[model samples]
Target: MSLLLLAPALLLVGVVFLWPLLRYAWLSGHAASVLTGLVPLANGGANWQRLLSDGRFWQDTLQTLRFAGVSLSLELLLGLALALLLHQPLRQRGAVRAAVLLPWALPTTVMALGWRWLLNDPYGPLNRLIQGLGGSPYGFLSTPATTWLFTVLADVWKSTPFVALLLLAGLQTIPPELEEALLLEGAGPLQRLWRLTLPLLAPYLLLAALFRLAQALGVFDLIQVLTGGGPASSTESLGLYAYLNGMRFLDFGYSATVMLGMFLLVLLLTSGLLLLRRGWQGTLR
Candidate 1:
């Protein structure tokens, strides 16, 4: 009876996940002939060889790493601060928590559009505020540096609530006695936070970081709507590049190669995260 119930899920996974992944990997290595759609080319390593020699691929990969790294770091820091703030015994804590979730709750497309409007150079509120403050209007999405900054900020705004929620859950799991013990040992508030609280929060912190890392790596809609990988491909991420190739350019063969590369990179990262998580659990035990 259990097997019967599980069969559908297993079938779904095989069909939706395993089959597509296998197809993508196969297509990545082959050339599509005009008549056959895709055929194994005689050039044994041509697809991979091309990928290796493609300067744009490496540049975009670096950009992706930078994007993910900056966004994750900022989100983790902000989320941790927000989580600690919410840990205080305040009136209207529930309302504050609900408000914090608003950005995360909004659809990505909607959030991106809202940000676009807010950051537009000529009439946007942000630039206007800067101008009012007697500073020159900065291009938030026009230049590469500015575009990256907005992308990071956008990601942080939308995702920090998730990290805070996870950290809040972890905070609740901690006993008050542990904090009291630290206080009794003559530890100051900062000491207790750094020494006692943060150490215990390591697992949750790592989990939050991993979650944000995965999401940031595959970020697309926000970047697309915000910058369109533009100001001369300055903000082109792997996801956007793949979309351009597959959808815009209709180059399925090249797109498959890019997708395969991303799949492998994400797989490696996820595997490493799992290993680290397992190690942390072992240490806890």
Candidate 2:
């Protein structure tokens, strides 16, 4: 009966999510480019072989992984702090919490474009401030080292609130009596946080990490609008590379293969995180 109740949702999910993935998988095994008249023909692992030796694909993979790791780390850390702060009692706390979420609520393109203008060479406020301090205006968007770092920062700023909200909900579910008991036992703030709060909050942290990791790994709009994968493709994500292969180069088969590879990479990393979480729980036991 329970399975029957979920049948519609399961079917919907299959069609919406599973269908596209299956289509991509099928397309990946064929040749479907302008040279092939955009018709998919079986290529017998040719695309996969090419992917193995594709230097640019590997470079984009590294960049994407780095971006996801750094940004997700920052987001998780800052989000936990913000969640703890919001979990406290304060005047106008609802308003404050809502304000904190504004960044996450904004459309991604809007936020990315805003960052692009803010980091524009010579005219952005940051550069203006640098000039006032007697430094030459810097090309933030045109610099390789700094550009990727800023993209991570921009991603962190926008996504942290979402992680915070998830953690705050987790905090809410924590029984107050547990904390009271700890306090009566002479537990300090840090002690309670480390011993009680974090352990209980582990599931939420895992949830937030998994969600943010998927988003960060598939980051496209922000990098596209902000950097356009410029400065020698320093900040190019796998999603953007796939987009370029499909749209710019008109190679649908290779593009599909890239997308499938990205899906596998995400699956691998998230699975590893889940395994770690399970091991952690075992140790806690």
In angstroms, how far off is 216's CA in candidate 1?
A: 0.6
lDDT of each: 0.86, 0.96
**Candidate 1's residue-wise lDDT over 47-160, tens digit each?**
678888988888888888899999999888999999999999989999999999899999999999999999999689998999999999888888876688888888899999
Q: Global lDDT for candidate 1?
A: 0.86
Q: Return model 1's CA RMSD, one decimal.
A: 2.6
My TM-score estimates for the predictions, one after another, are 0.90, 0.97
Count of clashes in candidate 2: 0
Model 2 agreement with the true structure over 1-285: per-residue lDDT tens digits? 999999999999999999999999999999999999999999989999999999999999999999999999999999999999999998999999999999999999999999998887899998989999999999888888878999998999999999999999999999999999999999999999999999999999999999999999999999999999988999999999999999999999999999999999999999999999989899899
TM-score of predicted structure 2: 0.97
